[model samples]
Target: MATTSGGDLSHFAISSVYGELLSEMSILTAVETGLLEFVCCLADGLAPQAKGHFFGSRNLGASGDTMRATIVLVDDISRQLGVGFSWKNENFAFLEKVAAW
Candidate 1:
């Protein structure tokens, strides 16, 4: 997997894998606000048979330097959606799409 960081740990990606499930609904269905809200909305409209989806977010310190908390929220979303989750830094070559290893 590839990893990247910004300005002495300005950002990081923490990920976990979960057993795949029948997810016809939007994986990000319950996220109400923030950068994720748009991604969730797009995911919600995807066809039921779509294979995979992506959600990405970044923090310019709007919520007081909460990178760890942001990562945890993404993990929690993965659990709720019943899918594996991974993240990548913007500077990385490619996003590391992870599944339960």
Candidate 2:
């Protein structure tokens, strides 16, 4: 018999949820939602989860321009909310490459 690891189980769960959501929306909308979730996680200081969503968004075919726009929107929203949220972090260093590709 085989067993599922914790990471595997979590990945399954995430996939199921996103799959359902993606089924109802356009791919672009779904990707934008993923990016929004990533920013929300960042706002709450959840870097690990944020990183996951960032890659997920990219995997869903979000364009480099879309990702860049999301970054700028998040930054502006953070400023408007008077919160000191920083999107620049070591964990997100791959974003530029992801965006480029």
How many residue pairs clash in all the candidates, one count each?
0, 0
Q: How good is model 1 by TM-score?
A: 0.27
Q: How many backbone clashes does candidate 2 have?
A: 0
| TM-score of every candidate relative to the true structure | 0.27, 0.63
**Tens digits of lDDT, candidate 1, 9-101:** 332222222112212225543222333433343334332211122232222122322333443565577669976533332322122322211
- Residue 3 of model 1 has an lDDT of 29
- Candidates in order have lDDT scores of 0.34, 0.72
lDDT of 2 by residue, 21-85 (tens): 54566555776677777778767767787788878888888877777787777778888998876
Error in Å for residue 86 of model 2: 4.2
